[model samples]
Target chain A: MASTVSEVAEVTRPEQVALRSSLWHEAFLRLKKKRLAMVGLVFLLVMAVVCFIGPFFSPYASGKINTAMINKPPSFSHWLGTDSLGRDILTRLMQAGRISLTVGIASMVLSVSIGALLGALAGFYRGWVDQVIMRVADVLMTIPGLPLLFIMGAVLSEWKIPTDYRIYIVMVMLSLIGWPGLARMVRSQMLTLRESEFMQAAEVLGLRDRRKLFFHLLPNLTPLLIVVATLNVGGAILSESVLSYFGLGVVPPTPTWGNMMDAANTLIDFQKRPWLWVPPGIAIFATVISINLLGDGLRDALDPKQKR
Target chain B: MNALVEIQNLSTYFKSEQGVVKAVDALELRVHEGETVCIVGESGCGKSAAAMSLMRLIPEAVGSIVSGEIWFAGRDLRKVSKEEMRKLRGNELAMIFQEPMSSLNPVLTIGEQIMEPIMEHQGLSKKAAQARAIELIELVGIPRAKEIAKSYPYELSGGMLQRIMIAIAISCNPRLLIADEPTTALDVTIQAQILDLLRKIKDEAQTAILFITHDLGVVAEMADHVVVMYAGKVVEVSPVVELFEEPKHPYTQGLLRSKPVLNQRRAKLYSIPGQVPNPTTLGESCYFHDRCDQCLDICRVKQPPLRDGGDGRKVACWLYEEESVRGQ
Candidate 1:
């Protein structure tokens, strides 16, 4: 009874605050109402905190290989157990998570910025500017994404790029593959907004083309960009994992989730060393799924036409 | 009074798949300072095309101003640079659209929307602009001006949105306000309120208004003078009282009669016969000939030139032509 009263108090407090805030608060309130989305958000926050900070507290934080304890199963000393080199898989999973999440987030931001800018330019200035940008996006979109990433990854390995440098390059490569789809979405939205009568009202106000595009046009595309950006994070993480799995991305020395999984790929290791591969696999799956659920919730929450 | 906006031989054309559509063909219009000149017409009669042309807002894909001289306060608008035009617009000349529902940005606060033109045209500081926005919103007769300013467009009623649109339009205190059917989307009481608001603003600001609408009743209430258009051509121009009391051209007569009269219990309302000529195929003959009741033999051959009627009125019909028997 006391907890229920507290819960009601908690919900009403935000509503009171929302009355003083802007429409963003209203959207946030709606977002809070979506159960799956809230759970997804919570899970993502937990995962992020754990991945970014948990590795420091582990006993084997430096990951000095103790080959004597190789292929040990779940036990009190090591929560998940030991890897092929007898490094703590639990500690490595946390470390791998940091790399994977950084790649996902940085690439998503880079691609969303490039995509939205190009899309706005195309939609606002529809003659030659539109044709040039859209055609470039179209050309990029025609090539399949996974194969393109693989080919780029293969080039990095062929050039024998340093493993440390490869993570940054892999982020850039994933963003390169990611932009065309988002650019198309933003452009089509820009085209629709360009036709809206409010835009005509803007023209009449003598607003400069820059003001019209940024203040008027781009602001309207916020919800769509947010949802697309959220979804893109998942795709980026998955792509990075695949790239790393094939021994091309942040390679063996880097301790990425993909490389950890890759280390346990031998026949003997695959049959016996579940701790090596399963933890990283579960982390990748859980993170991507949480992001997708959050994206779905944001789409609903941000849609102004949707009913309460 | 000097002409605030004088449009001479303004022709706007669109290239359709079939042929070139002369949306506003060689149109002539003049609005004196502090006067309300309503352009009355049926649909597809080029009223809006003329308005769009005067604003220089014709989208490259939609259409273009083929030729014309739009003189505003002694400057020929067509000859002005794009930058100068941008400066002139919303500062010296402002416009409000018909659809209040869609005219405002749904995402922005009404306060911010009103402040936009104030900042853009006047270069006022953000704080000053916001204060002026509240004042303007109050001037438009909205209560709780501060609260209203903070509210987004979707939160307002249609009448309120139109009022907010008016506030934004008048923010820069423009010399000319181009109102394209500003009240057509509102209910009767709201329409009257909006019209009153416009009249109040015009009187206060001494601003010239180029009003466009199909409603004769609205023309009667708001227009100081009326320009009747048909098939992309101005058929008549007259003082509003004279327009209501004695319509000159056949098109104007049809428009007045088509409006339903109160207390006249008629089963069927009067309607103009025949359709407006397809813009793609308009010929040399008077475009109204097929639909006009007083069509002369000459109307079937050469088009009638606009003739000066007494009392500063103009009519473009063969009935007023002194050489009435030219074709015969």
Candidate 2:
């Protein structure tokens, strides 16, 4: 074994590369086999591309209104139809997709960062620090999320917050509601992880607390974090729509999926003209269901205990 | 010359919900340079606790070191600063734990895990550390070193993980290696291989080993000296051959009898009746008194001190108390 090692070294290097691509590479392969998740991933990519680029190709790309053509039915000129403002609904739907997807993804990032960090700190430190962070989480959790978001949105509007900054604030609001749950989950997982033998092994290895927390601790929690973050994006989109229906999120002229549905919410449009509400409704539905499918696939794939 | 490591009158206490438990008390041990000292005891008998105390890993959260002096290489470990302790922990004094399955970070590559201490202590660059990690992996006798290093813990068997754990422990060439039941979690075949690997490391590195195990067979195989513990107190300490030839303490005697001999027939194997006493209410008496074959009246109410019985042996049974008086 010892004498042949020098000769074996050359061949071993390439094998090491194959081995290093390990868990994530394995997870990706597993995920590829799950057809529903693949479809979801493909649809989301296509939706993202169309939402970001499709509006630029439209004849009425600028959404210039024509009062005489108000609420026109579907035709070759407009694939979906014209809305109450006589803007092409297909272009508007694509435009709205951009804002909704952005809010979903941005808020997911915000919440996950805040949640995972606070939770890990609480679990690791676990004395007064745990008490303080968990109590705050508990307090936030006791109050209904919708009502609290409503109060914050009402405050944002009452303060005459500018329209351009509202999406950013709405992202912040969604994260504020989202983190408490994620933090609590992370904290509980961290508590169990702290008791794991590797932690004691880390202490013995004399790795600094900072390295232990980030490289050792946080990396282990990535599977949990990824699954939660994807799920959060879906939830964030729905919450933004709910807030938009109440005229609090990304108001008119912004073309958010929520406000588009709000535009056609009256009894006449709901009963007679099915075109307006249906497109934005389908946009929200497709984005959420795909996210859920992909998230579930990731959960199974990344799980260590998951059998083949 | 002074021994490599000397632990004097160490007492560690834990404040559990039930009450205060003396996890390790009146513990005395010495390991010379390159010597292997096997701490033999039943489960929960404070063998692991004593090993952790040497590395300053005991009394971490709910436990406290009530009293002790851990002298290592002319320095008292108990008095060192946290930074000094940390520096000493893996660089000069390293540890290998039981349960290799859970002892390694499941997410990390074996190379990354082993490279951690090499980088931290040796101040090597990442590339240098990776080369050193592969070297250490091969040094521990794992073939296809590069391939093994890149593999995750979950992919390996119990014995292989234990070998990696040993590789990590010896990466910095520590002066004293603590093995806390390192083979307890492996089957017998893997157990022998780990033992062999550890013995080879001890000889090659000239590193002292404080080996903790419940198996007499392991003690007979690896120990230069033996320290027999019962309920957190050292009952006997002797040279390996003398310990087997003329075991002194009643507890030691019972332990020897319990091992089944090869090609011998018996209706039943001898097992010491009862178990290690509960930590919370371990009274001041011979901890082995309840299960001792020849218990004196004094053994019920008065704890026997670990009396030296000449010829580099110490036994904590009242039966040997007269020998201390005669020698004194």
Candidate 3:
């Protein structure tokens, strides 16, 4: 017997168009209407645009600190107030946004690329390859990420690496260590997608494994990878901040959110002048929260099971 | 038509933790140009694996072609570089899948999916490829071709998605189409329509089809030749009519008998006595010996060779010794 849709049309295509027009499109459009997700999208867009443009209009070059304006409070001249070392807080904040957002973006790119590649190979091949890759991932998972980052930073510092390049060193460290969890998630996703009929079809069509992984299998994984990449940016930013708090991030003169908090700890400076902590702290909170919200929204939207 | 695809002693084995899993063992079949050959078996019978091995799609590290020659259009597939194989996918050969819902890229629109192979294989201009995509959509019987071409995978129903997949598969006008249970997920009436669509494509495009399925009904509906697989081995190969009317292999007989007849008043429907042996945990004996109604001591002691019966028919059974001798 024919299906309900099939009864309405003899060929497959018309029935699909009718069914889609009546159901799937409406449901998806309704979900895209979520207020919080849209707000999150706007927030992310603003932050991205502002940061992208921040370096261009920055008042002072990133390295220059004004000695005369040391530790000045918030005013019309210095919107976020001067830091302890007299850099324009606004300039420093913008410059720091460049570093923060770059670290977040770069580390995510590195991690996701490495993670997705390894994960696809592991999950698609399975057996010995899967066992070896997963076991290594398991070992990485057991090691606490923060402590590992600290140790890596200390080792790199002891080696007297270039001070200006310290932040990049930290980013690489975070990516190398951070990839295991994302890799595991990606591996499972690849595992699921590998068994999908599309993948089999690709194989039977004489498509190579690499092409199938890059095209058929990987495209299906976009939603999961997107969510993970967003959250990963948040994670990478936090790692940078934490590393900086311990004096391992972009050397002392360079203003970072973590360095701002680190500077605040001296002589109850933060309590006396509440403005110092608030600006960088708010920046950190705003960026992280918006990314998290975006991730959450995407997770909901891409999920095939969840109804609007 | 000359043979467009030929296989000789193709065996694909996986090195698993438990043991060596032979997913496709000594499978030999041929599909002439514009022919439709059905590789029919229940799940885990390695019909899909045989298809995979032909393309060398199984990962070399985990699974290897222990011994085989897969010649497609007179080229040895095993000797070709991976780059050449990828180029072959949408150019000389393409495939349709069982579940259309999962097969089409969810993020891509129908036009983009159809356009991909045209652009990749044929290097057609954007406008030209898009025009071809629309034509393909119409060719597959999709209505409102322009409008439907703009929709994403999730926007289409199962049957519609299958049609879209058909459009994409036939985009490059490949010579051979390996449709692995192409209509298994579709409704019965949709299955008929899809089978018809496939037959029409085969005739019009002159594309050979390596159809994989377990359904005898689907085989009768579409196949010109039939290969019955049991536990990774091809037990019988014959013209579809002969295979259905006088099947030589016991397993084929069992499979044909297992199909539920129309309005039959029955205490029980016929079924193969045991579940297919898991490939990872297979034994040395005849793959079907444990469940075969005609099992003898020799059947349990050793696997049977796929010996020729007569008139392009082959059977792997001890009972076919006289026919096997005549062929030798």
List DockQ, one per candidate, in order.
0.34, 0.39, 0.30
- Alpha carbon lDDT of residue A26, candidate 3? 58
Candidate 2 regions off by >4 Å? A1-21, A32-35, A266-268, A306-308, B16-19, B59-62, B273-275, B323-328
What TM-score, over all chains together, does every model reach? 0.92, 0.91, 0.74
Candidate 2 or 3, higher lDDT?
2
Per-residue accuracy of model 2 over B134-239 as CA lDDT, tens digit each? 9998888877888888888877767778989999999999999999989887777678888999999889889999999998999999999999988889999999
Write the number of the candidate with greater lDDT, choosing between 1 and 3: 1
User: Which has the better DockQ: candidate 2, or candidate 3?
Assistant: 2
Candidate 1 has an interface RMSD (Å) of: 8.5
Q: What TM-score does candidate 1 reach? A: 0.92
Model 3, A182-205: lDDT tens digits are 788888988887766666555544
Compared with the true structure, what per-residue lDDT tens digits does model 3 show for residues B194-313? 889999999898998999998899999899999999889999999999988998889999988888889987889998898888788766678888889988667776777888766899
Residue pairs that clash (backbone atoms under 3 angstroms), model 2: none
Write candidate 1's Cα lDDT for B1-328 as tens digits.
7798999999999989989999998899999999999998988889998998988988888789999899999999988999998998888989998999999888888888899888888889999999999999889997678877887777667778898998988889899999998888877777888999999999998988999998888888899999999988999999999888999899888888888888888988889898888899988999899999999887888898877787889999998876635545
Interface RMSD of each: 8.5, 5.3, 3.9
Give lDDT tens digits, candidate 1, residues A1-308: 64455335433442343265677888999999999999899999999999889988999889898979888998999999997678888998988999999999999999999999998899888889989999999999889988888888888889988888999999998887678788888888998998899998988889899999989889899999999999999998988898889887888767888888895678877887777788999999998999999999999999988955
Model 3: lDDT to the true structure: 0.82
Model 1 ranges with Cα > 4 A deviation: A1-22, A67-70, A158-160, A305-308, B323-328
